[model samples]
Target: MVKHIWDSDRAAKLPKGVEELVYRSNLIGSDRTVCNWGGGNTSMKTTEKDFRGREIEVMWVKGSGSDLATMKTHNFTGLKLDDIRPLIKRDQMPDEEMVDYLSHCMIDSKHPRPSIETLLHAFLPYKHVDHTHPDAIISICCADNGKQIAEDIYGNRFVWVPYVRPGFTLSKMIAEGVANNPHAELVLMEKHGLVTWGETSETCYQKTISIIQEAEQYVNDRINQHEVFGGKRYQPLPEDKRKQILAGIMPVIRGAVSEEKKMILSYDDHDDVLEFVNSVQAPALSQIGAACPDHLVHTKRVPLYIDWNPETQDVHKLADLIKSGVETFTSEYQAYFTRNQQDGDQIFESAPRVILIPGIGMVNTGKSYAMSKVSGALYRRAIAVMKGATALGQFVSLHENESYHVEYWPLELYKLTLAPPEAEFSRKVALITGGAGGIG
Candidate 1:
């Protein structure tokens, strides 16, 4: 496993209260072996010294939307420790209301809001908390008999919490569990993630690596490699054919973005995408599953399968096919919503974010082509992982009821609104050697 070390000298130069920040940043950076693509967060707590020498202990957690691998000093925010304590004590806070707390209770008052999970981090018993959706861990958790697998891999060192939306409720559960077993160092959130903490950041970070590596090895030994497969390849579409596909998809993509934002559309056109479009497994795109429950907001539950090719110079035919696919996807979504309705509330948008074309590449619906590409790229990754896990055994994610709770959860939507207009890529490039493997 890889061991990561942060800039100890640079961390020491920061204000006295930043010990947790230094620890968390390095721990996250080191544990990138499992999580990549900005999938996790970490936090630490200490008393902030005021100019008058009065001390106020605050939670310095990863800021919303920041990548853990390259997190910097400023990405950590000081949240009022007192405010979070009471909410956790109550063990309940409405989803949207929790987001409001994060937005309103700022230490500097003018700085960016803390992460949405800041409350969860603050409520934990440890001075430092690390959370990640490691690929290896998630892969195992998404399979049948995951509990047994986890027990065999992590043993009694970790505690498992069933899938819950990440917020006050999840924090409450963790708080209660910790109260029962105060010695627990790890919390394995079923179908969600792995949480590790320590007195110092390095201990928590190294433990994260060790756990994921163990899981990866266990999976390798148990699962047959031949059952795992990459996507299939397809023949290239001619110019007119490609243009027809774009014409059918562009309108849907345009309607999704706000009018004020400049929008551009692009396609994967990569070897993998092209191959998958024509492969025998193409029909599996719309199978009954999601990459992860959280991903439903961006990619939707499943993609629309476009199978009928536009006839030679038949514009109306292309339009008909597109409309048909849209209608089918909408019908399926309505069915899902009806079948999974918790209350009498109405459903959200019926449109799918990605459209899969047989014998061609896929189109991602987004405000801009870049954003769409990110969504599609993430979708492909999820599909690959799901397919890989199925090779070992039956693949599963959180149930639809659980998926719906998060899909309709107000905090998630609010978090989306709080994000900057366009997705921002990190300026720093992080590469960790010999850290953990496959959770992130």
Candidate 2:
């Protein structure tokens, strides 16, 4: 996490509300680049008093689709400050309507709708707000020991809240939590991510960076330095065996790819491909999950670990592992869900999308090769971050029940829901699997 500040060229000419826009947008966009895809938000509040002589009557906030890493002033949609203040004080509101109401309060008349979490940003009693699905922070939260670790690392400086749907209900939960822990400088939402704020844009941005850096450093110190496990050192295979191995993998993956994504199948797998595959951490890399709530649908709670069997040159054996991995995972997931579930909640799938085989490295087996591949890549980054988070102290994340609530929440269900009527068949497509080099 970098404590972002306005560049000298821009800060030198701070244009009132523009300063908040520049700093807050950059702060959020930067974090979004590393971990989230359509998942995070940020904001800044300006009271009517702050603009004493000016006609500007609203607070600026991040807009939907704006990447914090490269957000410009136009990326911020402004909202009436007075309108937001009163809503946060209210007891309830529908989630979807909240965005519409917030939109009506936009500070900039021509800008697109602001981020859906705008109200949640408003609920925070600070001038600047920052949130992200940081890979390192989230990896720790997904682990079995997440809660204890978080308590050990953050201590009193942070307030930890259970995972909630990211809208009115979530905002209400946070507002109440903040009221209870008024002194807390930071808030950590379990199975989600971190939130930090301050009196100024710089203060809020710097605080967020500093806190994340602290967690990163803490994790780094505890990383296992040795490359070899027990007496084994990972080594590459002979060129022919490698080619043969690739050949087998290519066919299965090609068989699973859709026509629109067929171009991806033609990509060649060579030593460079092998090298990339080999670089993935296998045995100890099983800890990564979604950096926040949204990522869970893609990566799941844990990755499957498989080791090479010398007697098994058969690809069917490998396929069996993939199938069995899903069964085993589903069983374990159900067990975890059943043990932690609240009233009326149902358990989800036991299938595994990403698998890590010791010597063979990582294999993605999702609905398509690309989707599965992305999941694998995500896990690698997450694991690296978790290793770093450990040095900060023990990692803490959402309790099991909290994770269940978010995973099964109606909002999340909307995403998991299938296409309606005949659209379901259209949503499905052909699957191609294999490399141009005659291996998959």
Best by TM-score: 1
The sequence of per-residue lDDT tens digits that candidate 1 reaches over residues 1-440 is 33445556765566655655655565565454455444667887777765577787777887766666676777778887876787765746886687777765567765556776777688786877878776667767677777777778777667778877787788888767766775576777777777778777656666777777787777766545643333344456775777676776567544443233434445666665665566655566446556565577777766777765433435456556767777777778888888887664558667667777755577776655555775687667565556546655676776667777667765556556665665463221247766776753
TM-score of each: 0.74, 0.67
Question: Model 1, stretches more than 4 Å misplaced?
Answer: 1-39, 50-52, 69-74, 86-88, 96-105, 178-183, 221-224, 229-264, 269-282, 307-323, 334-349, 358-361, 420-440
Q: Candidate 1 at 235: error in angstroms?
A: 8.6
Residue lDDT tens for model 2, 261-345: 3312222233323333344343443443434556565666666665555234456676565555556666787787778777877
In order, what lDDT does every prediction score? Answer: 0.66, 0.60
Those runs of model 2 whose alpha carbons end farther than 4 Å from true positions after fitting are 1-6, 13-24, 31-35, 47-57, 107-110, 143-155, 224-244, 257-291, 300-316, 319-355, 364-377, 385-440
Which candidate's lDDT is highest?
1
Sequence-dependent TM-score of model 1? 0.74
